[model samples]
Target: MKRFSFIALAKLPIGLQWAVLAGGGGLAGYALHQTGLPAALLLGPLAVAICMGVAGTRIRVPRLMFRSGQGIVGLMVAKSVTLGVLLALSEDWYLMLLVTAITLLISAGVGLGLACFSSIPADASAWGTAPGAASAMIAMAEENGSDGRLVACMQYVRVVCVVMLGAWISHLFVGAGDTHLPPIAAELPFTWIGLGMSLAIAFLGALSGNLLPAGALLTTVILGSALQLTGWLDITLNGTLVTLAYGVIGSYIGLRFDRATVKHVARLIPVIVAANVVLILLCSALAWPLSYLFGKDFLSVFLATSPGGLDAMAIIAVETGSDASFVVALQTLRLIGVVLTGSFCAHLIMKWNARVSR
Candidate 1:
């Protein structure tokens, strides 16, 4: 097989190169989807992009593409935010706070464990193991002068593991039968005006996110939820658009896992994997009591508490007839909490490391 070279790829127009990469990514995603893996669309494209990147293809996705992807995912999440879900959350506000705090502890503990066992820096491990938005964590790690590539690898690896494990648990333990809920966003009737308005909000949200922490995705999520909550707009994102968003986001993250990055984190791989498994199991155990207290099924509670990407967990929630709103709501709350406290927490980790070393 002829290997793709960066120099040869650079000779082509950037647009053409991107189009070719996108096509390849799509085909790879399709193949993976056929294999019945959870999050095949995302994992598939991501795997292919990583290989392409390692092979020296200089096809870089623009920042705008990822932001747009976030906007689309945010809009999809908004579909689950109904008045009933809001009321459920309001009634259980204290419990939500408690769960959020517990999740933070779990993340911090995992970060500390990784730092102690691996050669990665404490601050880097802290941000890397945070069960927050992958993009947000990576960006913060870079801003904090930590190794962004390593952080990205850790975050995404956890996501993939959490997703696959979540799916298995949903199927084996929860018995996620056929979805009973009506197709909220996926089946909604589409209108050009609605799409145009949604796009405008997404674009504005992306621009505003520049000034806010974890702003791009969270801002769009807030905007979309508010619009639906107030009955001011019915945001119906098309399936094709949502899939495109997933593909782009997956490709962007996947390309970061080039050969050099893999080599850099080689020794820490086993420790990272172990920590992820431990975190997932711990969170699931915590979910059991909460499930009884909340009068919800264990599966829904577990999905809500599981430390995975918001979009990935939400997808599992939808597919399994779990409480999509609850899952997304809890995940969103935790994401916000993580992003807000990420810096302070990282500082604490670094300080502790310094003191212990001394």
Candidate 2:
């Protein structure tokens, strides 16, 4: 009977699929606000994700969800990058590099700690689950013969941690009441054009099949923003759309953890938990000092240091009064940097660690 109901639930249409995500997210957001825990906003998506995984695994749906979600996320990321961020580079490339390097070290430390404590191999575990860039990390891990299951586990674990922790931390500082919808109502006329352009860019980006980290969102957003900047498109990124995307991405990420994977590593839960704690602590420690040096708040610094999904961090940035532009800018830059340098770093680290172990 339980299985029957589960399967039945899984067969819902894509429209209904989105409804479930939105409804659940709103409810979660409301509850978090009531409790004065802004970051607890992730709870809704987390629950939805677990459900999506349980249901999605058993049923077939339009692959559109996966593709569209990817497209929108990538475009959003790409669009968010602007002349301002590029300008930041000219003023202080060294600071950006320093921050990026610190984050890499922290991300690496998480990978190393996981390998030492878990049954996972150092190289596989390290590259498989590093939180900085999922696409890059997964690719590198596969290239290097890392255990896929372990890599997936590590990646998802970090995702969960960052999502949950970021929300929690944000709520602690930014009052929950302040977490209402975006200023969409005030910018209604502007939004129509924005939506049109966003959709066009999203579709085109998806069709292009680029697999860069946050590829779809990055692509669409860039194209859309360019259109907007150039007066070619009149689009508005209302709060509703942002929230919708956030929930969708979070749910998609959460639903990816299937039963087989969970069962396979049930015993390693403690290690995953430990690794999460260590990584969070290490990132916080590193971010705190940098925050002081940069004259920014700790949360912004922490978000920059966070090895979670770029989308999630950006969302947190918007909610927590962090310099959303700066966070997005640096995070994107670091992601590109990670894509370029991560494999080499992993290679050297794995080799050195292997030599020491032997």
- For lDDT, the strongest prediction is 1
lDDT per model vs. reference? 0.76, 0.65
Model 1 off-target regions past 4 Å?
1-20, 32-38, 170-186, 354-358
User: Highest TM-score, which number?
Assistant: 1
Query: How badly does each model clash, as a count of residue pairs?
Result: 0, 25
Weakest lDDT window of 10 consecutive positions for candidate 1:
174-183
Per-prediction TM-score: 0.84, 0.83
Question: For candidate 2, lDDT tens digit of each residue in 164-278?
Answer: 8877777777766765444332444655656776666767766654456666545665676577567676545565565555556666677667667777777886787677767
Candidate 2 has an lDDT of 0.65
Q: How much does each candidate deviate from the true structure in C-alpha RMSD?
A: 3.5, 3.7
Worst 10 residues of 2 by lDDT: 58-67
Candidate 2 TM-score versus the reference: 0.83
> Predicted candidate 1: what Cα RMSD to the true structure?
3.5
